[model samples]
Target: MDCLAGSARAVPRWRNVAGASRTGKPVIVPGLIVANVAVFVLTVVTAGSLNRNFASPWFAEGALVPALVANGEYWRIVTSGFLHVGPLHLAFNMFALWIIGREVETVLGRARFVAVYGVSLLGGAAAVMLLSNPLGPTAGASGAVFGLMGALFVLLRRLKLPAGQVIGVIALNVVISFTIPQISWQGHLGGLVFGAAVTAALVYPGAVAQNRRRVQIVAISGLALLGLLLIGAGAAFL
Candidate 1:
């Protein structure tokens, strides 16, 4: 459900509090990659197979099933982002994660990056619950990966940087999402829309204000609350 096909050139360095220039290598990116891989390993070890089977305990317990979520297994909305149907699913998503996560984490900083990712993941689950077959379960990190891509796209545009390659990559991915069987296009679209919206909320306020950091915090919190309300409505109606 995911692929890497874009590159971003390094931006000019900004000075830190000590007046020293820093490259800002990302910590959360690697940590997220590790957590995902560990969960995949645990799934393989526990389930003893990589094939798709909803009856599999891992899928039954963790994958996003609309009915199950509506019935109070709401944790699946988040957990499903960490689960995968097979090795290739895990590999593709992890590869995409590695490609984009570092850049986004560096640009947004650790806390805001985490917020974007968490909201995007929930957005994907909410979309799946509302738009896809209620009885079918979906699992993967494609939604989160797409969300990071969307965030990067918005950041590049806001900075007035060249965004042609990023736009092309997103277009290609959207086409692939629709053409491929078993792919969750609802999740992809939902994540992209929500990611762009949340990132815009986080970054646009800084454009006109001196207290940009405080504005960003307030904007992100408002978006988070809004996302929660949307997800709650989706679950209730499902």
Candidate 2:
């Protein structure tokens, strides 16, 4: 449900104190990629083909369906983020994730990175549940991947580095979302907005500031509440 094509060039910035806590190689991003690939393999095997996985019971049970969500299958918001329509869909999203997610992880460290991703994923699902057809299926990590792009943009700007490249990438992807046949523009926009907002809350806590972690926790939690509210609104609309 996303047309996440092309790679964005990484923005340059010095590692901040938060990133200094990162003592070793990044495990979260690699682990996410592996999980996505494994789930895709399972879906493909279940359906007996690369292209026909959508008809598999996995999709029936997992992919975001507004009608089903309204019926209390709320797990779709999380599970659908791991589902993809095909190999091309998976490749595009995971490639984008690998390119953008590692940098975000290195900058924010593992836990904060996961927080941003989780919030952005939920934001995307909320948007889809609100705006997309109630019975139509939508799935992909592009929403979460788009969230990484927003985080990178905010982080680059926080360091006073040039951020035009990130903006260009976002703009281009927005264009693709509109032009492509099946791309979920709603999910893309929601992820971008929430990603930037959450990352701003995360990195804007000054390095030497007191209660910085507490402030970040509150801000992220608030955004998560807002996303949940939006999901409720979507379900109500259905």
TM-score, per-candidate, Cα-based: 0.87, 0.91
Clashes in predicted model 2: 0
lDDT (C-alpha, whole model) for all candidates:
0.77, 0.84
Candidate 1: which stretches are off by over 4 Å?
A: 1-23, 52-55, 206-210
Which clashing pairs does model 1 show?
A: none
Q: Give the per-residue lDDT of model 2 (tens digit) for 1-238.
A: 0111101122223335333253256689999999999999999999998998887798779999999999999999999999999899999999999888878887777889999999999888888988998998889998898999999888777766677888999999999998998899989988988898899989786545567788888989999999999999999988
lDDT of candidate 1 over 67-90, digit per residue (tens)? 888889888888889888788888
Return the top candidate by TM-score: 2
Q: How many clashes in candidate 1? A: 0
Q: Cα RMSDs of all predictions?
A: 4.4, 5.1
Worst 10 residues of 2 by lDDT: 1-10
C-alpha-based local distance difference test score of model 1: 0.77
